[model samples]
Target: MSDPLDKATSKAPATLGEGCLSRYDPDDLSSEDGTEFPGAAELWEQLQDTSDSPEEQASAAAQGRH
Candidate 1:
């Protein structure tokens, strides 16, 4: 795997603050905690439509963007 901090990466570093931290919490989606998981359908609907290339599409799909 490529190290994200390596200069060769075309990726950006984490820029999100506390508000965006909710997306990473394992308990955030548990029904017992009074929240719902954003299932595949909800996830697909919420993704941005920016890339049309096959590679980009595959990457997005792998990341649950579709």
Candidate 2:
């Protein structure tokens, strides 16, 4: 069997700023252009389903943060 450390080191390094391997600095999410990504509507729909009304859902979601 191969040594585990040797196996890990032998693999190719990931391409920078590519795919999920890209490192995210907090500043990268500050601008609309930098932070624009898919799934806002779908996430909102999920939150809506968890509460009886839009107002209730928003309140519950706010509470969930803390």
Candidate 3:
């Protein structure tokens, strides 16, 4: 290709639904697409243990402590 932009161009995987409900089609995704996150569950649990619930955060923010 003659244009440098051609090398930078990338396309998203196929999607499903429409509007706010739209999302990537899982069946079309692969590891090459960076879809794998092996530590996500562990990280989620760690975050859950360290962070307060939404209601608690809102209360802290309203009290000007957040």
* Per-residue lDDT over 1-59 for candidate 2, one digit per residue giving the tens place of the 0 to 100 score: 87678756343333347678676555534544346657888988777576467777677
Error of 3 at 23 (Å): 0.6
How high is each candidate's TM-score? 0.24, 0.27, 0.63
User: Model 3's lDDT to the true fold?
Assistant: 0.88
Angstrom error at residue 25, model 2: 22
What's the lDDT for all of these models? 0.58, 0.61, 0.88
**Model 2: how far residue 52 lies from native, Å:** 1.6
Model 1 clash pairs are: none
Task: Count clashes in each candidate, considering only residues at least 3 apart in sequence or on different chains.
Answer: 0, 0, 0
In the range 1-66, model 1's lDDT, one tens digit per residue, is 986578563433334347645344553334555455568676675564543678888988899977
Error of 1 at 9 (Å): 56
Candidate 3, residue 57: Cα displacement in angstroms equals 12
* Model 1 misplacement above 4 A: 1-51
* Model 2: lDDT of residue 47: 72
Can you give the lDDT of residue 32 in candidate 1? 54
